[model samples]
Target: MEPLFRLALLRPAIAQDPDRPSVELAQQTDFQRALSAASGAPDPRTGLRRVVGEYVAGPL
Candidate 1:
């Protein structure tokens, strides 16, 4: 939950950046893939935790 909140806060900052479209698109794509993977897990809580962990470990 905490990590997710941090990501929510960080997303807008990324979106506001005007100098790096490629990097921004890559980040958004990674996030979407993480979300899709999480949705496929059998347990919602475990899935979300794994997604958040992966997100935090990824480029920020």
Candidate 2:
């Protein structure tokens, strides 16, 4: 999105290969759709924990 260009950063995105180190440059439509879908996302941790297992927070 425009914000990324301003910050000299690419849009946040998920890579196709989970084990690969890569950042997908989110297309405009994808960004907009993500924003809309997450507008009211609740209990996100529940779903995340399912895939990634018990949470472990690093020292602050």
Candidate 3:
């Protein structure tokens, strides 16, 4: 889950931004991770872990 996603869970207003830029970006980030995971392994957890690992370790 993303920061915005967590925030959304805590405060739904984050998902209701007028322009929705943050929401859109979060969704896009989620899509990228999902796509990466889906194409990477038979076990989704393995693939998702790889992606998340890279995300956490990669340059920001």
**Maximum-TM-score candidate:** 1
Candidate 3 per-residue lDDT, tens place, 1-60, comes to: 889789878964534556655435445576496666566677878777777787778777
Best by lDDT: 1
Steric collisions counted per model:
0, 0, 0
Off by over 4 Å in 2: 1-28, 43-60
> How far out, in Å, is residue 47 in model 1?
1.6
Instruction: Return the clash pairs for model 3, or none.
Output: none
Sort all candidates by TM-score, best to worst.
Answer: 1, 3, 2
Q: List the residue pairs that clash in candidate 2.
A: none
How many clashing residue pairs, candidate 2? 0
* TM-score, predicted candidate 1 vs. hidden true structure: 0.40
RMSD of each: 11.7, 13.6, 9.2
**Count of clashing pairs, candidate 1:** 0
lDDT of each: 0.74, 0.51, 0.68
Clashing pairs in 1: none
lDDT of 2 by residue, 1-60 (tens): 687586656556544876663775555764345454555468655545543332234223
